[model samples]
Target: MEMNRELIVLINARLVGTDPQYHRQIVSHELRENAVWIGAQLHGKDGTATIRTVAALLHVSPSTVSRWFQPGEFERECEYLSHAFKADGSLKPSIPGRGSGTGNDGQ
Candidate 1:
């Protein structure tokens, strides 16, 4: 999946209601979540979601996105992504307790 402006705008919308003091933390979390989701989607589609690809999609530095997760977290996310799809090959509507990392994280 290609990164589009709509996705960027939707991600930005999540910041509106966040407390200023915790804004950085929230942004970091969102970036990490999105990176994992996107990475998984790409992987499912037989493509790779590199740090640069995810960073570019999120409009953040590659290092910033990299710092958001441990190796274990990424592996776990990848495992989850492997099962995140339906028989039709589309992702499920939601990612269980974790939202889609768009604007659904309760801000």
Candidate 2:
């Protein structure tokens, strides 16, 4: 599973670098379709990031995040994750009911 995720990242990275705008559009579309491969890629580049951590970062319920990981959940909130973790942090998206947190729980 880990190896597969890494390979997916490598392929996507190449695609992303070659054409960033197109890559984002593809990723967004894949998420909207709830593609399992896209979910795995969103899981984390290293596959070590936890669901709870991802949920907290996105300011959504853990269940919502879990659904994003499912094979077909129509991940409407993926844009938030992509914007928060993948995009440049200069501008932040306003996520409803989530204000803006840096995922810091005073650890």
Candidate 3:
């Protein structure tokens, strides 16, 4: 996957500091967080965002981005569908079921 050069530059610009080491640390953290934010924005109600897409955009490893979607990681901020992402790093169709039904119950 190709990285988004513009986004990378933007993120790096935001991390400019006197300490190069510290800047690198902050950049890594910020990039990971931004990856999650981007994922959430692109995820939509249909889980359209794939891990590889987010990682590629943020210049991070797909596995690293994938970890953020794991249980207890960012569950409160965004819901990650367990079966949504396929092995090929693409999103599968999201089919609503069970609790996803109308609130009126089986009237």
Candidate 4:
């Protein structure tokens, strides 16, 4: 089972992502998406650094970041990441949650 690093970071969950590599891949992915949206929305990045430069701004390998905007593997990565982890940071049924959170706890 794979897990997303961003959700883990967002929810402050301690559960290790399915695979450390996958976790990194997810984080890198989110960062790329955020950057692209920002660039697109703000109407910036034009007459400026290219995607490779954007990758540098996001602190990821240019190739990796480029993959985010590209059509093929990027889409697959998104799918894998979605099925990888849940909103609350559960890594599917096989892996249990590992946080101090009490989402299902009775108050």
Candidate 5:
């Protein structure tokens, strides 16, 4: 979907008076969580989030995401997804001259 400038304005206004970096971090983390949850709903086999689904959304391999689920695996992280979200939170495929859209971006 096309970005709603008005909505972005409203959200940014509400975020005023708070640390911009902190808010950005929070939004980044939340977006990743949301993506994982949505991916789970679509591809999980047991009504739970799966590495394969989340990996697909993050543009990574299943093994990369699975490594994060391992016990005592703090070294692995969702840094890629965080950065990706910061770059573009839409989580849609981009096409030249046509903003990201599974089918349409309201353009």
Candidate 6:
């Protein structure tokens, strides 16, 4: 959403009054918590990073990623990683660019 002038002013004013420590603890952590840790083990085998890059590395189709991951899956992952990651995390496949269209991630 585009921020209007009033909203920008409010954000600026709030920032002015906000303590650096409190801002870091309150805002930064929340942003970090939502960010996908694509470098983590279950995120991808090698050095996969970012959702788009992970999808590319895994070769899983973009639609498949969107569907299986319900948008917030990464956020949940940032909060709680699980052992059933890769196995249970399996998603439906995309048509050729060429692959099984089963579980194969074009890899």
Our tally of clashes for model 2 stands at 0
TM-score of 1: 0.56
Q: Candidate 2's residue-wise lDDT over 13-77, tens digit each? A: 88666678887677655543444333344643443345555556555576765654454333433
**Candidate 3 local lDDT, 10-104, one digit each (tens):** 77677674468888778777876777666656654455656788789887798877665566465334445424445454666545554646765
Error of 1 at 39 (Å): 1.0
TM-score for all predictions? 0.56, 0.25, 0.44, 0.39, 0.30, 0.29
- Looking at model 3, which ten-residue stretch has the lowest summed lDDT? 75-84
lDDT at 82 for candidate 1?
Answer: 52
Give candidate 3's error at residue 18 in angstroms: 4.0
lDDT of model 3, residue 41: 60
Tell me the deviation in Å of residue 80 in model 6. Answer: 2.5
RMSD of each: 11.7, 17.2, 11.7, 16.2, 15.2, 14.6
- Better by lDDT, candidate 3 or 2: 3
The reply for model 2, stretches above 4 Å from the true place, is 1-47, 71-107
The sequence of per-residue lDDT tens digits that candidate 4 reaches over residues 1-107 is 87698866855545654477888877776797765543342222122325565566667687776666765544344444445344443444533454527664333
Better of 1 and 4 by lDDT: 1
- Top model number, TM-score: 1
State the displacement of the C-alpha of residue 73, model 6, in Å, after optimal TM-score superposition: 1.6
Residue 103 displacement (Å), model 1: 26
lDDT for 36 in candidate 5 is 51
Number of backbone collisions per candidate: 0, 0, 0, 0, 0, 0
Q: TM-score rank, highest first?
A: 1, 3, 4, 5, 6, 2
* Residue 47 in model 5: lDDT: 33
Clashing pairs in 5: none
Model number with the top lDDT: 1
The local distance difference test score of model 4 is 0.54
For model 4, the run of ten residues with the poorest summed lDDT: 40-49
Better of 3 and 4 by TM-score: 3
